[model samples]
Structures are given as structure tokens and as C-alpha cells.
Target: MVRILTSFVWLLICFSCAPKEESIVQQMEAKGPIPHPTEAPDQWLLAHIDVETTGLLPGYHEMIDIGIVMTTLEGTFIDSLFLRIQPAHPERLSPGARAVNAFDAHKWAQLGALNRSAAVDSIISFHKRAAGDNHVLMVAYNSHFDSAFLDHLFRSANKTWREMYYYFILDIPSMAWGLGLKDLNSAWIMDRYQVKDEPHIADQHTGITGAMVNVRIYKALLQYRQDLLAAVPVP
Candidate 1:
């Protein structure tokens, strides 16, 4: 009788200590859907940004190149900025990253890549010119990845990400997922939306090329949503 009672108590303790599984509905409620813009589309601007890094981690890796394609919220072309930033910590450059980005030290040197300070200044100036007093919305294929590196870059230059951009980021994959896309991969989404093939070669992928691809994907997704809504007959 005592052994049974002890076993029951142990089981109860174990159950209490175990992490509870959160329901899908609870998770959805916690995260919520991406919020709609409170203001008119034309009133805002989108900074389609892409950055090529030395590695994956922000502080460990350095941004070697940054590309920003500014557009009106409705996807009207505004202006673009591309900066080849000289890596501050060359020692941190990883072989995998080098293979992916095809980082050529000699070529970057010949191009006169901007130093970290100069790169940050240029980015700030670009945003000021594009947005004036308003904060530009950041749009990226993988916003969390790019934003982490970008925020680190800004911090390294004694600046904050919020100085030039809004707090909320617009991620291409998230947008596609929200639009009911089953396959979130860029290739799949592009094919589904009939977006043109990426022009840059895999070995020589540039930041500008990535930014352009992301912009096109975003525009295509927007159009797809519009067409879907339009197809539904109204009363």
C-alpha cells in the first residue's frame, strides 16, 4: 500500500515538472498574424534590403555587402543603394560563407569597399533621402537573419536600427505563408507566383541581386493576393 502511494506521488511530481505542450491555437494567438498598415500605402516606403555576410552569427560574422532597394509601399521604384563594406574582422570569415558569397578579397579591395563607419553613414543618408522624416519599413527575404546583422552593423557604428527603419520587419517567407503558401522556399514561391528566375549565378550571388529577387517576390505575392480577392464575386 505504501509503495503504491509513493509511486503515485512520484508520478504526480513528474507530471507537474514536465513542460506542458502548448496548443496550435494558443501559439497562433500568441504570435498573431502580421498587422495591416494603419496608414495609406503611398504614405510609407519599403526598403528591400539584403546583406552578404562573412558567416551566420552577427558579431562573429561581418556584413561584406549591403543592398537596399527603396520603393513606395505599392512597389513603385524609388532609389537603390549598394555598398561593399570592408570586413572589420577578416579572421572571422568562414570557408562556408566564402564559398556561398564568393568573397574575393582582391576584387573587394580594388572596388574600394567602404569602411564600417562610411557604410553606416551612407545607409543613413540613403534612408534620409528616400524617407525624409518618416521611417522606412524593412522588407527582406529572411528579415530576422538580415536584421540581426544590420542591427549589429548599426550598433558597431554607434547607431540604432530604428534610426533609419521601423521596428516591425516585413519578411517575404512570412508574407507568403500568411497568403496560404504551402511551400515557403523562394524557388517554390517564385514558380507559384510566376516571378522571373533570379538573374545572378549561384557562385557569384551579390547583395543587390538578392534584394532585387526579394522585391520581385514581394510584388508578385501582393499581386497574387489582389487577384484572389478580386476573383471572389461580391454581393
Candidate 2:
């Protein structure tokens, strides 16, 4: 009888710890339809995310900043959040990397940047509120680079909650290629769109501004794609 009770308790613990299998479609169905049908159109969360790190090398350098902008599929701006973290290993931050990001370890130290754990928790909370039941579709300039660090951030934050975000990300450069836009840097893209912002300038290149620029680039590329598709003759 004692052995059976112990085994039952263990089973309960295991079951409670497992990840719940629920897709976005099921979640939307449970919540019913969205209020605005014509206003925002499609439902998924469009997140233009950017990360600034100590250096380009993954694992070797820590992420110092994170920025995300949540928008509707129709390109309506919803909300944005920016988070910064202080590295435990600041010695690894090379002068070139620091100069590129305009980050000084001593300055951030004096300013009292958020520790890794706190920054991670805050970012997670912000994402949950922004995403809600809608699927999170991330758009980044160079997804592979950012994803490497973000993957580390999630995995390092809490192993249990690593599944909190989307598995895949969309690259803005790839979108531009598909849309037949010029394969140029974000500054050039912004120039083509006449956005009137010098976001790529080294001093102005914080994660927040970077994310905003990324979103602008995404919207422009999407518009180009739509125009091309509409112009195509039906087979």
C-alpha cells in the first residue's frame, strides 16, 4: 500500500511538469473571433525583434540589449519593449564590439543595468502580454545571428519555459529578395522608403531603433510583394 501511494505521487509530479500540447489555432478557437475584422485583418503577432550584443560571436559574448515591436499583420503598431542586461563577464567585450554598440561597461555598470535573470524574466513577461493567443511571428534582419543569442537567452533563462516563443523566424533580407527589392543594408532600404530616420548611424543604433527600422523595412517589402502579386496575370 505504501509503495503504491509513493508511485502515484511520482506520476502526478511527472504529469504536472510536462509541457501542454496546444497549438495557436486551438487557442484562437477557444477565445472566439477577434473584435476587429476589417481593421487589423489577420491575427498573428508580427514581432520585429533586434538584439545588440557584446560581440558577433555567439556564446563568447553575452547579449547586452533586446528590442521587440509587436504589430498587427496589416502593419499596425501595437506595443514595443526594450531590455538591457549587464554581462557577468564584461572582460570578454572587445573594444570594437563596444564601439559598434556604443556601450561602455563602466558606464552601464554605473547606470546599474539589469542582471541576466531579471532581464530575462521581464522580457518573457512582455512577450506573453504582447503575444496573447496569437502566434508570434518574428522578423529580424539577420535571423540566424539574433536567433543564436536569443536561443541561448531562452534556454539560459529557464529550461522549463524555453518553449514560450515561436520555433522559426523570418528574415527581412529574404523577404526583400522575394519581393524583388534591392539587396542592401537597412539604411538603404530605409532610404528607398524615404523613412526620414538615420537609425543605422552608430550612435543611433540601439536595439529599440534597430527594431523600429526592421519593422519599417518589413512593411515596405510586404507592400512590394503585394503589388507584384496583384499585378500578376491569373493562369
Candidate 3:
């Protein structure tokens, strides 16, 4: 009888300690909607992203730096990310871009190995955590070029970004057009919004700074939308 009771107790403990099995989606649903990442400036958490490339093309040119800043939805800057990379050689620095960023090719050569794949992984991981399962709007001054470059990199990486299904990339220039406004240059947005003290220079081609500029631009655009909505009279 004592042995039988012990066996039953062990059975109870085993059942109680059993791990529950659920699909990834089921687990996500149980956790409720993941918090949406703040890609634009607003009253809540916001993320500003930028990148500096060796040239116009991402894969062929290489990314030298990546920058991001997090702020409140109210436009108050909070945290920031400024990472420098060492890309492979033969990276042609445009005379125009070189004039601003002033990165000495010889100096940059000392940084270390070029890990573009690792950089992309970092972006994907960060986006996944920040945006959760919800799609986050990826805004760029010219998303066409930036987006295409990103696509090329991801496709070359042997990882499919489609698994996430949580990316919403929008070009600010295009957004302006969609709003029936002419294409606004980054400088124009900066000047109009008076976002001089935000971070980064538009001409320097510093990826980090460029991303920060995009964030500010995104905020300004949002404000523009609000103004438009306010201006229109209700039917």
C-alpha cells in the first residue's frame, strides 16, 4: 500500500510538471498584441533609424554606420544608437558624400572586419522586439533606394524577412506626393520644421545620422497630416 501511494504521488508530480505545448501563433495570441514600435515621433515611444553607406548601393557599397534614436511621441529624444562598421575595400566614397562625413578611408580601414550580415540581423532583431508582431512603418527620405538596398541585403543573407510579416516601409518623399504635395527634400523638411538640433547631417552620408533625420522628417510629416485633417471641413 505504501509503494502504491508513492507511485501515485510521483504520477501527480509528473503531470503537474509537464510542459504545455502550444504553437508560436497561439503563444503570441495568449500574450495579446505585441506593443507596436514607435517608428515616428509622437507622444509615446518612438524610434528614428538611419544608415551610412560606402556608396549609393547597400550590398555593393557596404554600410559603414547605422544610427537610431528613440524618443517620446511628443518629440522628446530619449535613447540613441550609433554603430560604426568596417566594410570591405574598393568602396568608392562619392566626392560629394566624402565632403560632408569626412571619413578618412585610411582611418576607417583600421576599424575591423565588415559584417553586413550581422548588422542586418541586428536590425531585424531590434525591429522584432520593438515592433512586436505588429507592423512598424519604416520611413526613409527616399525609401525607394534604401528599401531596394535593404531587400538586396536580406535576400543575399539566406533569411527570408517575410516570416515576420511585420514591416511597413514608406518613403517620406512618396508620402508627400500621396498627400498631393510636391516631393519634399530632407533639407526642406529640416528647414520647415526647424529640426536643426535633432541629430546628424543630411549631406554627410552618415547612416546613423541619416536615420535620425528620417525620424524627424517622419514626425514633421505626421504634423503636416494633422494640419491637413484639421483644415478640411467635415461634410
Candidate 4:
């Protein structure tokens, strides 16, 4: 009787320590429609963002600077935020990355660049002013690249990226393709739309400049699509 009771107690302990399975209902509920950040569900603002990173990979690389340009759905300028972040792990910076952004440690120190925490705080404040209570939809030329680095930055600062922006990202190249633009290359699309040319020199590649260019490209695409639809004539 004693051995049987002991076995029963051990079984009880094992059951208690076992990991709980997630309920399918709970998972489905969590994926239910997300409330629109703005009063009008269809009218959330766009956040055109660009980031200059220390490397290509997220966990291994770090964001050196970020540029965010907020605009209305119709592409009217709202506000902008640019932050130069002092590298937390400079040793991990790739030589090719340095060549691209001209990441001079001395110049960054002289400019008094914000550390990760301060940069994250500034980003949050900027979003608050631009988005108010709602989240902005992220737009970028190569969104995945920028979003991944930004995600790492936010995580490192112990902040949630979802609070500031939506999970769905709008890609400029994809938009161009959807609009029947044959060339998906940024420079080609920009030239097609008569937008200003991006800088040619490697070191001239900065976040704010790229962000501004991307925003222009997005606006151009929107205008092109509108013109095309207008030419179609109403049935």
C-alpha cells in the first residue's frame, strides 16, 4: 500500500511539472482582427523608414542610424525622425558595412550620437507624436532588411515594436511590380517616375536620405496608379 501511494505521489508530481498545451481557441482568438489605430479604420498613416546598419544580419549586426518619415495615406508630409545610434558592439561591425555608411567612430563620437536606450526613447516619443494612440504602417524599399534590424534594436532596449508600428509591412518594390512597372530596381523606378537620383558614392548612403527617396518613390507610385485607373474610364 505504501509503495502504491508513493508511485501515485510521483505521478502527481510529474503531471504538475509537465508543460501545458496551448488551447487552439486561445490561439485563434489572439489572431482575431486588430483594432485600427486611428478613428477611421482605413486611414492609418504610413511610416517610411530606412536604417543604416553595422552589418546585414540582425543579432550579429547593429543599427547605426534610423530615419522615419510619417505621411498621410495620400502621401502628404506629416513629420520625420532621424536618430544616429552609437554602436553597442562596434567590434562586430563588418568592414563592408563601414564602407557603405562611412561609419567613422571619431565623427560619431563628436556628433554625440545617442546610445541604444536613448535612441529607443526618442523613437517612442516620435511615434507618439506622429501616431497618437494608433500604430503606423511601416513602408520601406527593402522592408524586411530594415524591419529586422529595427526589431533587434527595440528588443535590445526592452521595448515592443508592435506598440509603435503594425506587423504588416508595405514594400516599394512589390508595389512597383503590382503597378505594372517592369523594372523593380529602386534607381530604375525612381528614374521612371522622375524622382531625384540617389547618391552614387558608397559613403553618401545615409538613412534619412534613403528614407526621403523611398517616400518620394511611394508617392510617385500612388500617383501613377491613380492616373492609370483614371485613364481606364468608368463603365
Off by over 4 Å in 3: 1-48, 69-80, 109-114, 160-168, 186-189, 197-205
Which candidate leads the pack in TM-score? 4
Residue 79 displacement (Å), model 4: 0.4
C-alpha lDDT score of every prediction, in listed order: 0.80, 0.72, 0.59, 0.81
Write the number of the candidate with greater TM-score, choosing between 2 and 4: 4
Which clashing pairs does model 3 show?
42-73, 42-74, 43-73, 43-74, 44-73, 49-211, 50-211, 51-207, 52-207, 67-208
lDDT, candidate 4, at 181: 78
The full ranking of all candidates by lDDT, starting with the best, is 4, 1, 2, 3
TM-score of each: 0.80, 0.75, 0.61, 0.81
TM-score of 2: 0.75
Error of 1 at 46 (Å): 0.6
* Model 2 accuracy (lDDT, Cα): 0.72
Decoy 1 TM-score against native = 0.80
Worst ten in a row by lDDT for model 3? 19-28
Residue 147 lDDT in model 3?
62
lDDT of 3 by residue, 93-205 (tens): 66655655655556665755246577668766765565553443455666556666555555555554434433455566776677666746656555777865343354455
The count of backbone overlaps in candidate 2 is 0
- Alpha-carbon runs more than 4 Å astray in model 2: 1-41, 160-162, 186-189, 197-203, 230-235
| lDDT comparison, 2 vs 3, better candidate | 2
